[model samples]
Each structure stands twice: as structure tokens, then as C-alpha cells.
Target: MVSKQFQFSCACGALLAAERRLAGRQGKCQGCGAVFEIPQPGVLSTAPRADAIAVQEVCGICQTAIAEDDPRTLCQACDLPYHAECWVENLGCAAYGCSQVNVLKVGPDIRIPSPASPLPGSRQPGFPQAGQSPLGASGYQGGALPSAVDRAAASPTLAWDYLWMGASAVGVFLSILSYGGPSAVTGLAALVAYAFQQDKSHWGPAATSLLLSAVGVVFGLRLSLLFWQAT
Candidate 1:
């Protein structure tokens, strides 16, 4: 779910055909540029994507180009393409402190070991295989981001999020009904307080902050007008 198809190459400057997924700590491709999906795992392809290059299906790990006639269902975390059997035999979840949950087969399998699923896409995001970026990056590329990265990016503060949402709503309500008084100021202050607690490092918090602050400002202006008229 968090995985994205990166249109860029690995941390190295090699040109890769398939999109790269973030894996490991470095956010680089699991195999980086050295490993690639192909007829063989250890074997490297002279041609990145042969003749306009179509991997048919990519390894979902490394950004390698599988050979036209190769047999493999998935690639290692490093992006080393492997046949289904090779994947089951060689690669599995390696996260520490997580048993039965971390190591398991993709989709479903008896040997890989995972909770059986009755429907497709039933698995949640942030799994080990998700969010694997290539070892590193520098320029622009197109591809879905890895699931892990998304989770790492998403900071869950349920209470804080709710608090801010409530404050913002109160601010809106005051602006509409009170026409500027304690209610208006209350909304303004609440909005600012809520914004400070929001997580915008990953998304565009700055923009939201500006927009919300502007609304508060307008409320304050209306309040000033009301008080001035009373004077």
C-alpha cells in the first residue's frame, strides 16, 4: 500500500526501467543498482529493459528488469528478482521481535506463514515489504512510495489531531455566529494552538497553517469592528 513506483534510478546513477521501492534503512532500492530482477538472481542483465524493456512483471522489491523468459514471482527486499520458489526459500520477513507477523509469504502460502486472508488487499499497509525506497535519491522520479516510508512519515497523534480539529471547528462557528467577541478570539487562539500540535513535516502543514491563520485573522478583524462601533 505504501509502495510507489519510482521512475528514478538507484542511489547509483544507473538507469533503471522499473519503478524503485524504498527498502531497508537507507530508503534505497533493496538491491540498489547492483542487483536486478532477471533470469537469475546473481546474474545481472546487460540490457536494463530489453528492447524498450518490459519485465512483464517486476520483482516488487528491487527495480530490476526481469528477462522476457525468466520465471519469478517477486524480488528480494534489495530488488533481487527471484522465482516464487526462490523467494520462499531465500527471502522472508527478517524484522526482530516480530514473529508470525513479520516473516510470512506474500498474498498467502503455507510455508511463508501468515494469517490467511479471504479477500484481496485485505492486508494492511506498513508491512515489512512496503515503503522500501532505493538506497538513496537525488533527483525527480515517478513511482509509488514504499508502504514503510508512508508509515514512518505518518505520526499518529489521535488525541492531538482531534483537539486541533475541534479547535478549528469552534473558530469557524464563532466567526459565523458571534460576529467577533470572546468567541472570535477563542476560536483564533484555539486554531493557532491546534496548528502547533499538527504534524505537517510529512505533508504541507505550513500551507494549512497559513490558511487557518488567515481565517482567524479575518475573525479578529470583524471583532475589532464590532468593538469599535460600541465605543
Candidate 2:
């Protein structure tokens, strides 16, 4: 509720921090038999959550640090930390920031088998995904991959569709003049090439416009071939 300045190591040998203070559950350490007195503000710390492997302890909910000295028994899903009074409702730990608003508590019975079919365009158009990491342990090898920014900076996927479409435009003109049948093929090829470009260069409105232009070129070529062939 409030980030208070308190440090009370459970005399039961549990840790506590300035932002997160807890009374030993029922005045006794649940993990180890110990009693704790809330440490004074200056006696406790206000540092970022730190561990050997976990360089940072950010709450998955509010993205706040679960301070290093604080009891980590609290779930990152809730922002509110456990206090001497409210430890009971928290299942007896100092869970913080995870109010469970957008939480889906997974268990053995409720199995989430591969994203329930993504709801046909329910993805947020162009947003980075949520929970996009392996938790607890790295079960697979070489699973860690580069981020979007890293890939883009390394070797940008260029707009090759423009080159193909431009060449196809010349082919379309040549087909109208000489190879009338091939004119349709060239225009169709332009559309196909543009589709490939759409897959990679979905950067902004400009790339979209280029892809749409390729489509328009296909229509125009088809129309010209029809009219010219008829005459």
C-alpha cells in the first residue's frame, strides 16, 4: 500500500527490507523457527532487488523493484508487499505489486496448451509479446535469441519488392508492345514480389504504400493487356 521505511528481520532468520516489512507469520517463522522485530528505517536498506542470477528483481505487475533486503516470498504479480498485519491474506509471504488483475494462475488441471489459437488477428497489430522469456530454468538449449532491435540493426531487411516491381513494370510495358501474354505474368509476379516485401518491411506507412502500389500496377497491367489485345 505504502512504501514505508521499516526493517524487521524475522528473528526466525527471515530477511526484511525498508520498503517491505513483515511480522513473522503468526509471530513465528514459517520456514525456520525464529522471531522478528521490524528493523528501523535507517537500519534497513532501499536498494534494488538483486541476486546472483537475477540481476534485477522487477515486479512483473508494476515493474517495481522488490528491494534486495525485502522478503522475496511475495509474488511479483502484486505490487503491495506483505506487512505484519496483512501476511495472512498473502498466503504468508511478502508478495508485492501482483494484485492479480491480469493474472491467470496456472495449475496442473488448467493446462494452457499452446495459446488457444490466437483468436484470428487478436494480436495487438504490432506489439512485442508478453511473458516472452523462459522462466525458472532454461529447459532448452540455444533458446535465447536476439531482440527485434538487435536483428534490425545487424542487417536491415531491405525493400526488394520495389526492385522487382520496377523491373516488372518494364516487363509489363514490353509485354504490351511485344509479349502480350507475358505482360499479365509480369504484373502477377510484381504482386507476388510485393507480398514478400510486406513480410519483412512492415516498418511504417511508406512500405505499405509501396506494396499497395505494386498491387495497383498489377491491375493496370491486366487492364492494358485486355484492351490492347482486344483491339
Candidate 3:
């Protein structure tokens, strides 16, 4: 015959069982590492009472039916039942206000929860907290740092830089036919494009545009001066 066991709970909400002979002895709670004196005989029951069995309780974490014969434990704080596996998977009691909500390892995995992981009901890595907007209070979405591609896409001056470059090219072509009048505008447009460009990769193209605009200005001015002197 199997010897009878006595069931007791720790202050941290861990359910513990010991042989009936070990009653009134000191025991340590595996959940929070708290040592406490075990209650004497008749203080706690080994199994759920008849009324509790008839109610068909569910696991607090998974919300599934817990069979009468299934391995389970109860949270000492809120008196909620949880499956043995569910308790280990969730790391502790799933009740919201229970003190053991963040308590680690009521089950076999005795290691503490990693600090990098967020506790239950807390904000996740990519999510916004309470009262925060979708883009977050800091204006970045998903709480992630802005990447190079993101900065490039959001740059307001990039469009203006390209527009100035295009204007510079058009002005240079006009200077070839209209003498020095268009060269002045072409040189100014090229200077603005070069100054506003932020990306280092485009520096070579900007320099080329500036040089070509300068040459156009000089050529047009020389041609205009020569023609005026001859006429």
C-alpha cells in the first residue's frame, strides 16, 4: 500500500507535498526558495474535496478542463488550479493580482526568468505601452531604432536636391543656345544641389554637375563678350 501524503502551500503560492510522516518538519518552497514549517496532520488534505472535484476546474493559463486524475497544482495566493505542464510553461501562477505572477519555477525548470524577456501583462519588445500611440510616444514605430533605409525614405531634403539637379541640367542645355543669360541660373542651381545633397555616395555626381555648370557659364559669357565686341 502507498503511504499517505500531506499537501501544503508556501507563501509564494507554491503547492508542496510531503509524506505524512514528515509533517511538522521544515521544508523549502521550490518556487521562491522560502523555508517554512510544514503544517501538522489534519491541517491540509492530500486531494481536492468532493465539492471541488464535482465542479470540473480548468487550468488558469491554458483555460482547458483539468481532469480529476490529471497532474495539477494550485496557486496558494488565489487558489487557482493549473496543469503541471502549464504551470511550468507559464513559469508561475497566471492570475493577474497574485504575488507569484512573476515568480519563477514552480516546476522542473528552476532557472530564473531572463531579464531580456518581458513578464506577462507587460509591454512586449515591439509593442507600445498603455496610453501610447501606434507610432509610440517617441515617434518611432514598433519601438525599433531607425535604420539607414528608413532615414533615407523619410528625408525631406532629398526631393529638393534631385529637383535642383534636374533644373541645373536643363539650364545648362539652355545656356548653350541662349548665351550667358541661362548660364547664371544653371550655375546657381548646381551650387544649391551640391550643398543640399546629404548622401556621400551622390557627391561624385554633384561635383560633376557643378563643374559642367561652371564650364557652361564661362563658355557662354566668353561667346557673348566676343560677339558684343565684334558688333
Scored by TM-score, the top model is 3
Q: Rank order by TM-score, top first?
A: 3, 1, 2
Candidates in order have lDDT scores of 0.37, 0.38, 0.53
Assess every candidate by TM-score: 0.24, 0.20, 0.26
lDDT by residue for model 2 over 152-220, one digit each (tens)?
343233212222334344444444444343444444443444343323334332244344445545655
Clash count (model 3, backbone only): 0
lDDT of candidate model 2 versus the reference? 0.38
Per-residue lDDT of candidate 3, residues 115-183 (tens digit): 655333222121111222212211222222244235335442333334334444555555654575555
- Poorest stretch of ten by lDDT in candidate 1: 131-140
Q: Estimate the TM-score for candidate 2.
A: 0.20
What is the C-alpha RMSD, rounded to one decimal, of candidate 3? 19.9
Which model, 1 or 2, shows the larger TM-score? 1
C-alpha lDDT (0 to 100) for residue 5 of candidate 1: 32
- By summed lDDT, the worst window of 10 consecutive residues in model 2 runs over 131-140
The 10-residue segment with the lowest total lDDT in model 3: 126-135
Model 3: colliding residue pairs: none
Q: Give the TM-score of candidate 3.
A: 0.26
